[model samples]
Target chain A: MSENQSILVIGADPAGLQASKDIAEFGFRVVLVEKRDELGGAPIRWKYHTLAPDFVPTEKVLGPLIDFVKNNKLVIIYSSSIVDSYEQKDDYFKVRILNLKNKSVSYEKVSAIIIATGFEHFNASLDPRYGYGINPNVIGINELEIMLSNGKIVRHDGKIPKRIGFILCVGSRDKATNQWCCTVCCGISIKQAIEIKKILPDAQIYVIYMDIRTIGLWEKLYWKSMEEYHINYIRGRVGENTGQEKNYWLKEKIRLLEDLLKLCLI
Target chain B: MSENQSILVIGADPAGLQASKDIAEFGFRVVLVEKRDELGGAPIRWKYHTLAPDFVPTEKVLGPLIDFVKNNKLVIIYSSSIVDSYEQKDDYFKVRILNLKNKSVSYEKVSAIIIATGFEHFNASLDPRYGYGINPNVIGINELEIMLSNGKIVRHDGKIPKRIGFILCVGSRDKATNQWCCTVCCGISIKQAIEIKKILPDAQIYVIYMDIRTIGLWEKLYWKSMEEYHINYIRGRVGENTGQEKNYWLKEKIRLLEDLLKLCLI
Candidate 1:
């Protein structure tokens, strides 16, 4: 909370940008570093279009934060830079940042160090069963988002898909990739489903999920998607994804509740 | 539960039709009566374009219920009929239904009676201050819905409104009218806002509310309306409604949260 003291924040994404701004507002200097050339994180840089659950404009939501970070005199932003070295020197953190743009390294002693490195979307190409990279029709959620924002939500043959299928838990919540559930996926998928319906009103959307984790107040979104959007939902993970000439086929595993011991019949 | 017993369902709306069909499926004869000459309720009959929160087609939602009620042998529908009289006879009730289509009265002895008379929209005409009948621009939520469904959401002069405003808690949640929050209004308004945005992407929509009562999952609808749809929400009640040649003016009473005892500054 002093002018002399400063906080070193790594990764100038949404979290990093927001934290630096908040700390600067509290009368502390902040040095925000980003490996990328710009301050906007993967979401903005990659053009994610809209935010999940609400589907508000991504720019509108992040505009104020971006503005605050830019205008704040106490916060210094290091674009195209990475932390070269970091050492704990008693109460202070001695850190060296390498600026890729200038080809020079700078040392800074800060009172506190904060790491706000953002996350990466699971590569759908790793899972061959989904035919992500192989098939032109099959795409990851992040890719679909970028496509939607760019008005490219079409099949490989440049035609609006009559029926679009969203396979939930592509990488997350799987034994092979991530064993944890990406809680935001359900809301994101629901939001995307609504967005798709808005663009292609006649298109039928089906979501195949292990379990919809849009719990609590977010459950309303899932229900709305079902009742209002008329989205079809099947409680099972898709097994095989095959790309034909025009249509993409998804083989779903139908499991019966009564036959708990029996394997799923695809 | 037996074929000999009968259940009387008042009002042949969605609830009545579905209930009668459900009861008839359980081997009980159901007599569904409506004063209006329609099987679908006010919502269906009035043709609300899309159901709130999710924006699903209303016809798709109510189609199955209407189909079941019409096809079921045990479910007898009496359109243009009303409950004339009722009397409890031991365990059964003798009810008289007057047919509006024909000048005749029919009596039925039923084991159980269900009152499924749906709600009505608050008459905006009664509140002269809001200029319901005076101003064509200022309309009730139900009227807006009918207009939206009919593709008549344009101005009275047949021009797209660049700015549209909604005054929440119209009649239901007031001391002068019905003393209960018409909970569906919030979601309905939210849905209407989104629908309007879809049609007129450049149009600015604002909702002036005393308090947004979009509780639980319905809150997601409110958030979507705010964040995704970019609908503006002002936390206050409009006191005056003045319609000019083109623009409709709303006088809002802004209250400070700190001043609990102090009156709202209009």
Candidate 2:
């Protein structure tokens, strides 16, 4: 745990920043590298919906990530795409780091390496039926993240749509694409639903999904979104949205009530 | 919207708080009532994990809620429950209030009612095979919440059990029971799996779910939990939790993964 002992961390995201903080805290010299232009790679954030008065602001959940990097005395390289340049000495190896912005490269000898590169988002356009790239309404989770952060709600046509239909499992949990479930979707959807409902109280939200994968206490948030926000979740796959007529959108709007409340289905 | 008018809120949860704040801000007196002694009817916090380094501290999330109450002049009635509450009058409603601690009942007149009464937790003990009540290791979602917050990392026993299993659709999505997805179970389970993996690093966590219902960007959190947490999942139901193994207590513990990480059939 000496300053001379170097730690090279690839990828300057949450994992990389966290590693940098831990290493520096333990008296280790850490140098972080990112292929992206800036930090907070992939523009991904995980959240669950919460109800607030007057849609007032709550906590910035990622404050810790920012504080970690800011407090940690670690070298950070941005807009640099370090590539396969390594020098083999008698006992260890030296790595070559490249700076894409300046078109300059540098070599650094490190004792240890940490590869915290995160995963890529599953393309919703693969299904084609989901219409992620084709339809103005359909957007991936990352794009949705950006929109939610803007603090202003807008629809595909510039005017806010009265009804927004969110379809889950676009490219996830499909046997053809990937059998594994993307675990955070349930929370994210619930969080987004809460936000949408808060911003537009009267707007109708239809969530068509194969399943609602909310487990643990977080299950409470799912029901919170529905019971509080009045969101309607119907179990079904996305069957090619034809862009319905204005009158039909109002007429077809369904009231989802659990007969359990009445002890009978109407 | 006058100070003379008293608004009767059905429950003192998040939604009730918002309603009371809005109405009271408009120059109306608000009465917040809850059947429970404490606030936060359902404890589904966002962006929280026990062992996860990225978990945000409580000061950040709850700070706003605290600030709002201080700024707004409001009345909160604790240890009080509402009974026979409805719009009994044209301008004002006759509401019955009960003090559970003292077994005293009284009546109050109010202008409006907001039903923020959250849903009751699922009674998983009804099913004996699940060992909800019979087994020490087995517990419902609410109990798990307490254990998690109080640090039940390893399991019931001091030694970290090699395997951990989460059975989804416990009180929800069960046809014979509520017949509806409590809706948050799936994502909560995934987040729990990630959390469990974080605490036990090598502990085998399996989420046995019929389906994963993550809507939109919420699917992003689901994916993060699955891909990053290294938590394994099984697409099967636990008919029962009966077996005699290393210990009599651990025997009741559900066996989810044989070799967790590698995913061995045997």
Candidate 3:
């Protein structure tokens, strides 16, 4: 509770930004650090077109957090920085951060430390059957998100897809992968599918999932997508995406749709 | 599970529509009746602009139900009609519906009945302090929803208000009223508040509440409204609207902002 005591918040994402502001507003100096040159983290910097469940723009979602962090005088932002070392000194942490912006290192003694490095989207390239990096039409959810955020919901050839497909459980909840549900991808797919439908109303959207994890009130979005958008929900993971244009096979005729786009969301 | 058995569904609202469709899909005859000229109860017909928790268009919310009702041959709809009387036989109920369109009563023997009349907004006029009917600047949440749905989010005089205030617990949860918390009101106010903010970004929005009942997953909307939109949350209900052009009482000073609008939601 001492005014001189400080809190070191590593990563200036929503959590870190909020923690820094909340702590700083309570008469404590906060050293908020992030590796990105700008703040707002992945959800703001990248994978935020429309937020899940609500479908409002990411800008509106991150607006207040950004404003609070930017205006708080007590929050000292260390962009393009990382907490390199930590030493526990009795009741406090003596932390050394490599400040890449200044080409220098700085040390801070803080009563508490909050580690908020955020997360990395699963590397879809590791699972090659989907032909992620190999096929021009196949992309990961994060990539699709960035594309959608920038108003680029189309194939690499700059053609609007007549049918878009989402293969859920890309890296998570698999025997070979993390063996746990991502818990977020289902809602993301539902949200993105709705957005895509909004953009291309006649576009046939499909979700290939092991199970739609949208439970409780979040199920509203999934229901809305299925009922209103007429989004097709196939209860299986897509085994492959051949490099051939208009690939067709039995029930896999869904993959043969012209100008097809696929999102491998883990 | 006899195929010949029928179910009588009252009130062609979302619930009735869904019940009728569901029963009909299961190979049962459904007699769906509504006193209203059209389908979709109040939420669709009168109050819903953008639904809570997600904020999508009401048309999208009601679209699938409408589609299901329209396409199902087993689901017979009777608009401008009401369930006039019910007589129980050995097991099934012999129901008489007064067909207002034909000026005659028709009888139907059905196995069961489903009443989906839905809810009515508490008459804000009953709470005279809010000045709902008397004041031009004052309105209820239903009015605001209709306005939002129809792209008419403006004052009675056709001017956009720079400041909007919402008084929660308009009739419910009070000594003089129903004395039960209308759980939907809190989420409704939060959703409307956010929508208002989206429409008029510079508008100073306020929610005067006994308690904001948005809980669990629905809490996300409340958080977004407060954190992102900077909507102010006052802890007490407004005591008066006085029918004054610019009510300048101390607490009523919030209502005195230039181009002010007030919504009372029970």
Candidate 4:
């Protein structure tokens, strides 16, 4: 890692920020490329119950990274788009990026590429049973992020939902699909339940999770939410939707939880 | 709500802390009382996420409350234990409290008694799935709370566990028993995660929550934990324990989350 050598970071989420931090710490000229003007990315805006208090806004939590960028005079390309093109420049990998809004293309020399694009949600439209595309309010956790940022928790109908149900492992950890626990829904559900209670102390919240994956220091978070907050948790998987309401899904999908305790509770 | 009538408050938790400030502003004598030796109560032992950035401790967070206590000479009872209960001759609630280690009991009179003792945990033994009593290492969030106050993430084995599982909604939101969310878990969990992560960046963390409850302003903490520290949250419950590890479960109870993810990921 040479100070004169340039390093390219592909994504601009928490992972990318971390990578930039690691590389910049080694005295390398770094170029942080994000497709959005906002460097904070998903975690900054994505809606969910679980958030890290230390994970403040980009300008705040990412202060060290920003300072390193300023001190090193690193180039940041916001609103930049990248293509999977292989350019042979001195027998090295040369990636090309196009600025979508300006319609201008830029090229950069890279000594090493840190692929920290982070995870993505597979199409919810594919699973029509959830009524995602058919229902207005049937949105993923990411869509809820911006609204939550503004301290807004009400649905589009402007009604503070008395009963909120969450379906976890929606696209993750299913052998039929991309089998991986997005590893977040459980924590998000608890976080949301807590937040909802904060706003509407009387509201009822339900979390339907196949499993709650909270390990390490986070186990305490899971236990505290469950034992202290009083948010209900059912061990089960939600199935297809049945009906629709005023622009939103009137009926949530159904599925039988393998656990007898869950079935009896719900 | 009268200016001339001096108001009295008990328990310097959030409610008492808030009430003391509000009433004092109205030009009245506000006597805020705390049974504990400290002002912030359990929160002082518990690392909180919604604290000021100066790394302010729980006692310091009540700086305003403490100031009011000092300026107005608010009523404070340290090492005092509530003993005999009764009513006053003047119709106000009269109570007797014995100061521990001093071998003396004191009696006091008050116009009103605000039970701001906050909500205590239902206990770890209540949830057998967590292996609370069956296993010596499986402690509740409060146990970790004490250790965290000192700013270290140590395990029962005297070394950080490669993997620690967080089982959410243990006693509060059990679908079979209680359906109510305690409401503070998400924020507290986020705080613990960040603090633990800061101390042990090498540890693999997981938070298995039935749901996440960050509620309003605290949602920031939830997202920060998930996005920044790579704290993995799996939506699942604590399964049967049959392991014999002296730390996670026991010799015959259950094997805590596999101790590989944390090591392999980094």
Candidate 5:
């Protein structure tokens, strides 16, 4: 096919990859560009263990799509590349694609351009109250995903957490940080909770949240975590993760209650 | 345009309407079919007051789309109609359209067919434990949406309820009812909670759920309901809503606690 018949698809994410493939299948060349060195988007880059709602392995969902886009003869993938500039002509678009790796520039004309740049995960360290950067224990959900994928749920000290606590809406739904809610975090957190439960059955898990927003079919994750896994859901926002040795009294009271219950059972 | 060049779009909902409009814009005649008499789908049929997450008015979203599809000259609408039969030819499909209202039949041939038939709301009455059909006070989220749109949050006796309890996952995420989670309910319930709070400031709202799966940007609704409206979220499942007077002891205890708190404050 001629250059004018090519479709420029930015961001080699799942959407972009699928778009490129579909357009290519329709007897059109696709110029697929990605800022990252990789082809698959977040699921590949972040190494997502399992997707929420169904908890299907990330590889299982995105593997074939990525492979298809990568191997498609019609799809010209430009990894570590970005669209430097584009000029809309009468019929086609005059585009300048830049390679970030070796500082190379390629100019091409395409009939249409599809922008599929997926979202960037919110920086958890932005909110100091969560003690994300300060406290070693307070890692973001992204890091947790990696851990789950690695088959290890451990604290900064490399110790298995006995009582794990998930603080939801860390940077989301906060006027101070981001006014908008990071919708998937709730589901992701629940998914992680269930995973953690599966790994460490005896480990007590508590999800402190304003609301557990596992919307739609992802509601299964929330339900499963609650009913099957017995993960505790607390309705409240975290004021701050001081990481201080405070609330000893509450711990002591719980211990006493546990002791009393154990004696009664005996 | 010839009949073979036209495209058939099933269900004149938002998706179908949009699809029809787009196909028509591409210089192709679109035959839009709807089971209902109306052009707009669920939002119009259910008289939905406001959509969740953003809480945008239903009309504000679907009204224009419906009007556009209704006015589009290239689009032919068959309301109260069903595709009786369709035979796939070499390059086109011979379709028999039946209109329920007039018992009329129309024959058409289209090159492409777009099936955009949306989902049906789960029947809450199927689960007898919720007392949906038996109890007038126990209504589903659909009924709640209508009530919210009508600007009246009341029981059967037309009295404002002092204590409103929203039981989430009534027919959803239940092994006995539906094993699959009805994802939108969590967000919808939270939206309703906020709406009810706006109408009844003094009413104590409790959302009983296994998990409040208000996933994604809709997390804002959950946050808003909890932070602004102070809606109580109880983490548990309801076995049965017998509508019996067996909870008098708990009510008495709450009353006594309130009295004690009042005395302490005084």
Candidate 6:
């Protein structure tokens, strides 16, 4: 194939890998690039145990796609690489790809480019109110996923949490933090809640939220967490984490006092 | 260039239209088929006033897209058409296209086919507990969107709703109705609630839901509905809509009696 007929796909995430594979399957030469040394994106990098709604193993879903793209003859992958510069020409793109490891640069001419750089996990530490970095027990959903994936739902001190509370919209749905809702957090929390319940049935799990935004079929996780698992859903946002016995205190205007009182009593 | 190089795109919804446009832009001949006589899919067909989350006019988002696909020279549109039969050949598939309107059959060999038929609005009437069809006051979100878009937020009697209650997850996230959560309903309800509050500021809006699944950025709608619009959210699955005085009664397992009692008092 000619260099002008090649397609440059940036990022090695699930989306990028799938796009590259699909394009390569259409008999087009695909130049796939990943900034990191690894191919799989956030899911592989973050060590995501299972996906939301279904809780299917992350590898089970993304493994085959990643492997296919990595092994495909038509797909030429460059790890630790970044798109240094690009200019749109008459019918093709003049591109320069820089390899971070070897400090080498390669030039390529491609007809089209697909940028599929996925999102970054919201840094919970940015909003100090949650005490994510300060409090050892207070961990983000990403950390919790790793713990759950490893079959260890223990605190930093290696203690099983009897009363667990998931503070939703940590860095999301807040004018102070991020005005956008981290949509998957609700579903992830609920999925983790159900997983935790399966492991520790007697443990009480509560999800504190301004609104539970588990959109789409993932609503099953929300429903299952409530009905089957008996996980409690509180309709309020947590103001601050005082870290008193690793319990989250409510704001001034509490909506569900009964549940809060139950939490306090526990 | 050749007959086998042409791409067949089924459905003329936003996804299909966009797909056809993108493919045609890539210099591939695209056969765009729509079951309806007119293109532009559900949003246009349903007369959707505004989309959810942002509440942008449906036409504003889909208008340009439909127009581009229709006017594109590389795209050949077949309205009121269906793929009767398709057989995989050596390098392409021989597809028989049947036009329902003209009762004409056309054969084409296409290298690729994309099916982008969007979803159908859940028939709220399926679940009789909601009293959707029986009670004139009970209307689905689809109808509500059209009403809100028409700039009329009135009941069947053409009276402004003073105390409006949005029963969410009507045909979604229910064991009897649909096991999957109609993700958009929560955001749509919140959007409509805000729109209604804008028109009728004195109107009190309440969202009755098992779980508010407004995932991601749509969480803003949920927050705005509560904080700005003063729309109340009650946590519980509505058992039955007993349309007494055009009001809904709660189930035996009422979690928020305060809100329900407040409703009763109102």
RMSD for each of the candidates: 28.4, 19.2, 28.5, 18.7, 7.8, 5.7
Ranking by lDDT: 3, 6, 5, 1, 2, 4
lDDT of 3 by residue, A32-92 (tens): 9899898888787665777788887877867888788778888888889999899999889
Question: What are the lDDT figures for the candidates, one per model?
Answer: 0.73, 0.59, 0.77, 0.57, 0.73, 0.76
Looking at candidate 4, what is the lDDT of residue A160?
Answer: 61
Write the residue-wise lDDT of candidate 4 on A143-204 in tens digits.
Answer: 55444566666665776656666666666644566544455555655555566566667766
User: How far is A229's C-alpha from truth in model 4 (Å)?
Assistant: 24
Runs of candidate 6 with Cα error greater than 4 angstroms are: A1-3, A51-73, A99-104, A157-163, A197-204, A220-234, A245-247, A250-266, B1-4, B52-74, B88-91, B96-106, B145-150, B194-204, B216-241, B249-266
Candidate 6, residue B51: the lDDT equals 81
At residue A83, give the lDDT of candidate 5. Answer: 98
Alpha-carbon lDDT of model 5: 0.73
Q: iRMS value of model 5?
A: 3.7
Clashes of each: 2, 29, 0, 66, 7, 2
* lDDT (tens digit, per residue) of candidate 6 on A55-115: 8999998999988987888899988999999999998899999999899999988988999
Give the range of the ten consecutive residues with the poorest summed lDDT in model 6 chain A. A257-266
Worst 10 residues of 5 chain A by lDDT: A257-266
Error of 6 at B196 (Å): 4.0
Best by lDDT: 3
TM-score of chain B of 6: 0.89
Quote the positional error of residue A259 for candidate 6 in Å.
18
Q: Which stretches of candidate 5 lie over 4 Å from their true place?
A: A1-6, A53-60, A88-93, A110-112, A128-163, A194-204, A226-235, A238-266, B1-7, B48-63, B71-73, B84-96, B101-113, B119-266
Q: Candidate 5: deviation at residue B260, Å?
A: 28
Model 2 ranges with Cα > 4 A deviation: A1-3, A44-72, A76-78, A85-93, A175-179, A215-217, A244-266, B1-266
DockQ of each: 0.01, 0.18, 0.01, 0.03, 0.33, 0.51
Among residues 3 or more apart in sequence or in different chains, the pairs in candidate 5 whose N, CA or C atoms overlap within 3 Å are A183-B216, A213-B214, A213-B215, A214-B213, A214-B215, A215-B215, A216-B183
Q: What share of the reference contacts is kept in model 2?
A: 0.45
Clashing pairs in 6: A183-B216, A216-B183
Q: Could you give candidate 2's per-residue lDDT for residues B132-247 as a string of tens digits? A: 66556665555554545656554455555687677776655554666456555565566556655666787767666667665544465677877787666555556665533422
Model 1 CA deviation exceeding 4 Å by range: A1-266, B1-3, B245-266
The per-residue C-alpha lDDT of model 5 at residue A120 equals: 69
